[model samples]
Target: MSKTDFPRRENFCEFILIRSVGNDSYLGNIWSDEAKFTKNGLFKRHNSHYWSNTNPHVFRERNFQESWQFNVYCAIRTDRVVALEFYQENSNSKL
Candidate 1:
């Protein structure tokens, strides 16, 4: 397969720290419109946040955008960004 085979699909992504229910964790909603995928997995136009493939053409990602941390990402692949996302910052380092 080639990179063109993977269709660009729009989607919304949000991460909630499950341990924050009552553990007093400050991690809150981490949302991003940059949840859209490509042959490169998830990506964001603002920063260099992207997925890393383990092998050639393998869809499984071994590394994530560690620099992304806790932020709402907006994707820009084609020409316009239509996805909407909302998120809050957390005092923790591991979002």
Candidate 2:
């Protein structure tokens, strides 16, 4: 590691320690690499007998395609919400 990198790393570790004080609430924060889910009216079983199953494999795949998914970023402090952000479908922010 270079000496120049020490300040940046030190700042990050300091930030984590400060944020973590008395609050495990940091664990609720969503990370970039984690998977996110959104609700979409696709694979859900709305009707019981509306569809017939022919090939189980194809049906299984169609179910997946019909489901909905999305990502959200939010932060909750001790007794108050510090941040709540809903990103666009194309937003790619990471931390």
Top TM-score hit: 2
lDDT tens string, model 1, 1-95? 45654442211122223444575533433323433344454445456544765545545344555434433556443335545544545323453
- Model 1: residues >4 Å from true position, as ranges? 1-70, 89-95
Per-model TM-score versus the true fold: 0.18, 0.30
The models' CA-based lDDT, in order, is: 0.43, 0.56
Per-residue error at 78 for model 1, in Å? 1.8
**Please, what are the lDDT tens digits per residue for candidate 2 over residues 1-95?**
46878999999779978988888878566433222444532223333343556756443323556565655556665466666655436345553
Top candidate by lDDT: 2
Off by over 4 Å in 2: 1-35, 38-64, 88-91
As a whole number from 0 to 100, the lDDT of residue 77 in candidate 2 is 50
Residue 19, model 2: Cα distance from true site in angstroms:
11
Cα TM-score of candidate 2: 0.30
